[model samples]
Target: MDLKKVERVYTSYAGVYDQIFGKVFHEGRESAIRNLNVQPNERVLEVGVGTGLALPMYPRHCRIVGIDLSEGMLAKAKERSEALRLTHVELQRMDAGAMNFPDDTFDTVVAAYVVTAVPDYRKVVNEMIRVCRPGGRIVMLNHFRNGNKLIAAVEKVISPLTKHLGWRTDLSLSTVLEGTTLHVARKQQVNPLRFWALVECVNAKNGYVVLNGAAASYANGNGAAGYAHGNAGGHYASEHSV
Candidate 1:
């Protein structure tokens, strides 16, 4: 994808983007944050942190660094951070495939709806894990290829159009993790589109497990194991096995 074109598209939509797509893409934001399990005062990094939607949900005392490729998105994110008084969160305009951070620099790293957007998904994931502490978590909320054959067929049909519309319809969450050290700790389906999924995993560990079934349901204020909708801003809380 052309970097300039991507920047232009997002920049053009930055102001009204949330209003138009928030309900659709922001559903799992809170869940992704909770699953991160960041401790107070820990260093955290969020990739593709559009408009800083997750900023308000971070542990209040933690230091957060957010990176995105779109300067237009960062401008809105900066306004949001300032408005919410999120003094600890910093925003930077950077590409996900190429990060400027050092190795093992953060306690936790997060990527929300970012995998599909980047041309090189694996490279970005490797970078995310590289910068995270050995035992740290890499929490993600994204759209993937559902194992259902019928759904996969439909996704294939619309993939070209979806891609043209600024969405990647073919990046399977499971496929992307292949040959990597990231281990799946939990997973849940979030939408019928068979695209949105919530996944919690640790970097380079054995005894990996893939959750096979429906999305989880939970009561209010529960934790990481609950039902979450969309991608970023909404999620039901519940306890999860990590």
Candidate 2:
């Protein structure tokens, strides 16, 4: 997944991206924000905020900084922000692998449909963790390699072909979290056929559990406070289990 190619592919899709992905991925976007559970006046950063489809869904009280590498996509996002009169939103064209923000700059960091699209998913994830404050939330909404062996094989075969469309199909959740201080507090399967995943992690570099509400208060029996499987009412997965 070359960065230049990804940019070109999204630039071409910018005009119709909302129509193609808006409704299909709407539920996952909404779920990801809900998992974020942002507080008033918190600083939030969104990577790969293509077309800003999730813009209007965020609470207006929190400050939002949305970034993407594709200029064409950012243009559409700008239009959406203006039309919605979202004064709290800010849009910038920036690389996900190399964000300009300083460490611990944001209260929450989100990346929807972003993990598999970048050239180096690990680099992007590391950058996300670097910018987000310790104990803050880092929400990811995207498809991971299926757990079923048969499906995983099929995805591996199709991954090369999908790269041209600006995403890969064979990335695993464990692979994305490798070597990171992020702890998977919750993960839920969303979208049609449950093809996509909505994962919420705590930036646990400081060893603090900071997620709020019932989701955070519910004990997982392992002493953790979040659910591992949102649909099954499962216990929370350990830090590396996601």
Candidate 3:
């Protein structure tokens, strides 16, 4: 990925980014964080922590270290952290695919709406799991290939243009999580218009099992609601009734 180009675009638009994508972006973000069930004093690391949108949602007692590839984004994130008076949060410019932290350094790792932005998402995911403790969580809030034919068509049609605009419409969350140790804990469709979603997962074995599913009802309350049926293709979607 062209870090210079990414930094330039984000820096130039930082002032208006919130106003432009605020509605769709904020909803998915809030839902993702809420479903995370983060506890106090947890050491958390946020990859691609652009503008520090999740900083305010974190517990005050938790320690947070945010990293982004774009210096422009990190600058805005620093401003947000200061504005929120989050003394425990730190912002730095770093690549998501290559983190500087030690292995198992963080109790929890978060990546919100960032999978699509990074050039090498698989490497980034592996890096996230590598830094997280054995029993810790990895939460993701992102937009992916919705099973709807109409939306899929639209995504395919505009994907080329969207890619130029910093959007990777081709990467699906379902495929992204495949064969990874991060288990899906909870997931909900944020909004169809934006194709956004809130998904939570935990690291386990060679592949991640859905931790919030019927097998582990204690992980999250959603499991007790009974397993909701969906298509067999592995893609699931839930309209934002929240």
Computed on alpha carbons, the lDDT of every model, listed in order, comes to 0.72, 0.82, 0.70
lDDT of 1 by residue, 1-242 (tens): 55676677778778988898777765588667765555556777899888887789888867899999888889999999999989898889998888899887776688888887776788899899888755456778888875788988888788877765566776787688998877665677664463588887655433323233443333211222223232333222222333
Provide the TM-score for each candidate, comma-separated: 0.81, 0.87, 0.81
The runs of at least 3 residues in candidate 1 whose Cα sits more than 4 Å from the true structure, single-residue gaps closed, are: 191-195, 205-242
Q: What C-alpha lDDT, on a 0 to 100 scale, does residue 78 get in candidate 2?
A: 97
**What global local distance difference test value does model 3 have?**
0.70
Give me candidate 2's TM-score against the actual structure: 0.87
lDDT of 2: 0.82
* Count of residue pairs whose backbone atoms collide, per candidate: 12, 0, 0
- Runs in model 3 deviating more than 4 A are 191-194, 205-242
1-242: candidate 3 lDDT, tens digit per residue:
46566667666767777778766588777776666555556677988888787789877866889998777768888888888799999888888888899887876788887888777789889999899865466778788886888888888787778766776776778789987876565677785465677776655533323322233212211221212222222322222112
Which number leads on TM-score? 2
lDDT of 2 by residue, 1-242 (tens): 78898999999999999899889999999888866656667788999999999999998978899999999999999999999999999999999999999988886789999999999998999999989866566889999999999999999999999998889999999999988898776788998889999888767665544333333333221323332223233232224332
TM-score of 3: 0.81
Those runs of model 2 whose alpha carbons end farther than 4 Å from true positions after fitting are: 206-242
